[model samples]
Target: MTTDQSSPISPYLTFDKKEWAKLRAETPMTLDARDLERLSGVIERVSEQEVIEVYLPLSRLLNFYVGASQALHAATSRFLGQSENKTPFIIGIAGSVAVGKSTTARVLQALLSRWTNSPRVDLVPTDGFLLPNAVLEERGIMNRKGFPESFDTRALLHFLAEVKAGRPQVKAPVYSHFHYDVLPDKTITVDRPDILIVEGLNLLQPAKLPSNGEAIPFVSDFFDFSIYIDADPELIGQWYVERFMRLRKTAFRDPAAYFYRYSKLSDDEAQATARHIWETINLANLKANILPTRQRARLILEKVQDHTVQTVHLRKI
Candidate 1:
């Protein structure tokens, strides 16, 4: 581990991939190729080597954090002279559109679940909280679909509040990628799990404060721990185009797909369309909203052009 030479008082301790891997320290690998295949995204690759090096140490660290949090909660309960309900440990994963937040969250959920105690872990994506297409169209902001404003932040907060309060059968709406919309009748029941992982593009976005110091609970206020996936914007753009092309061959070929119109485009046309969308929407969103919150994360996983994490900058205790 190393500290930034430029900022003598920097809050983070930096670790190269090799240095971070050493921290795995006897943490056994629990995932196979099949598990990786299931957890990864269209272009995101989660190899066994990544699991052994990057995620194992992260799992061990999170395990320790969870244990400590539980102990602290227990102590607080004791001080109050009563037993309190178990509060789920919530982790937030934030990054750009193609930054593989889902892959990372799913991998963590799997590893965390396989711990000796086998705690119940739930994974939820904020895509479910995205405003419906009709709503977006009505608001005349359909082009800003993944922007922070596109989300039903109030509903998201309510869901998190209920989950944190140990409510049973808390329902979160589901989003279908094929339809590119929130399913009206579909919901995921989150039953007071031991852990919940919330993944999104803007999970760490801060709320604007009032002059009178009013409490405005932002989405990240509910997170006990947070991670930011970092990579070059250019590389991410390339990956986005690559993923779009792949989807054109697969999902876009289905007539029911929201982006089915792009399926018939020639290679050049498809590439141009992908690039246009990336530049006009995704890239703009990243620069204005997502990238700004990178420093807010408890841990930052900086990825190389190849999409594997090359370094980790962890906020110090």
Candidate 2:
């Protein structure tokens, strides 16, 4: 394990890839290539090696955390001399766009579900909480679609609150990437599961205070554990552009796609358009909002080129 020499007394314990992989020796590998293909996002690569080295250890660690949390809740219930419902263990995953946050969430969902204790793990993405396209246009922030302001923050908070309160069935709005909008009158029901994984770009951000100085609950306040996926800004930009180009040949080619225009453009033209979007939108969002929350995560997975995690930092208790 390689410790951060600069911050010798920091709260997080850092480990290189090799050191982290050793922690998963007893964990079984249950996923195959076909399973990975279903879980992977567009243009994102997740090899079987990554599943064994990175996700297997992560799943084992999560199992420990979940068991500890359940024990704590049970002890509290006994102390109060009352029966209490078993609340779901929530995990938040945050990262910049194109940093493979979705892929990580999906992979974790699969791995965690295979565990005997947390077989009913569920995944919820914050994209569904985003305001519809018409609402964004009405607010005159269509160009800033992925910004914090573009999300229905209160709705997301309420959803998390209900989940934590042990609601029998909670519904979340459904988001369609092809239409690039939140579907009206559509929702995905989440029954009380053993675990829930919430993935997004800004879940770790602090709450916004009102003029009265009252503090509102942030989405991350409901998270028992959180992870931040880290990578170089320049490399992320490159990956974003590459994914955009790939989509031009795939999803963007669909006639109903929101970004269908890019599919008809020449390769050079498409590349230019991707660069513009990254520079004007995604990159700006990353610098101002996402990167600032890196230290807030309980764990950080730092990736090198070719999208492989080279280091893992786990916050010490």
Candidate 3:
């Protein structure tokens, strides 16, 4: 992406490949991960090394918001209820799959924790609230995983409410990426923190189409701030397909892996299947649900094909 000279932001990103070199000067550092190379079977380059330069500024920016949110929370709590302690500031992060939102959330957690005023930033992924495989299978929606309807919405809302209400400790469900399912009997706890970040694909989606007149609240209502990672649909699809094909050659090869059955396919055939899944499942979900919620974000990080953030679109308050 090339910088828009007209735009106020420095090194404004535009749709030009040559601009990347010029914009590299604006980036601070890059994350180094040999592990990403080992894990990804399809990727030719481990540009996760780009993470530092790409996300460090983002983390610094988010730390500012986290502090502001906490200050606002304290003011509101005092104004409404004189003696009550304020809860942590909650930030919601939403984006389509393979857009790197998970990695973003983790990096934010690490960076936000380094802030002097707020050294504690807790991250919770909505994957934990996904319905068990049995339930999805029973409902014949096993193929619709990551869709808004596949989660335990009420339970997720309840957990967020408790966290917002200043509960000393809160427990959240946990999910396993390897198993591709929400784990049973395993949970993560959040002792009151300075900030809480909730990440998921459908986190910013509006409530389901109404049936009757009354509307039910969703977890996003608890967010003090929200972020949406923006990307072109074609780019996201390509990334997803690339990741899937890579995983097939590695993770799927593990005999005990849930997707092990698909590992036997030839590379060419596996790549074709990955593309098919992206078109039929992921791309459909992005259009039907996620893309529509971009307007809901307080800030949007727009990325290009090179896996670097090009522009940051912030909502005018």
lDDT of each: 0.93, 0.92, 0.77
Q: lDDT tens digits, residues 49-103, model 1?
A: 9999899999999999888888888899999998688889899999999888888
Residue pairs clashing in model 2 are none
- Against the correct fold, how does model 2 do in TM-score? 0.97
lDDT of 2 by residue, 1-317 (tens): 65565586877888988899999979999999899889887877789999889999999999999999988988998999979787999999999999999999999999999888889999999999999999999999999988999999999999999999899889999899889899898898889999999999999999767889777888889999999999999999999999999889999999999999889999999999999999999999999999999999999999887898989999988
Give the top-scoring candidate (TM-score): 1
**Number of backbone collisions per candidate, in order?**
0, 0, 7
TM-score of each: 0.98, 0.97, 0.83
Answer with 1 or 2, whichever has the higher lDDT: 1
Task: Please report how far candidate 3 places residue 60 from its true position, in Å.
Answer: 3.1
Report residue 135 deviation for candidate 1 (angstroms): 0.5
- lDDT at 134 for candidate 1? 98
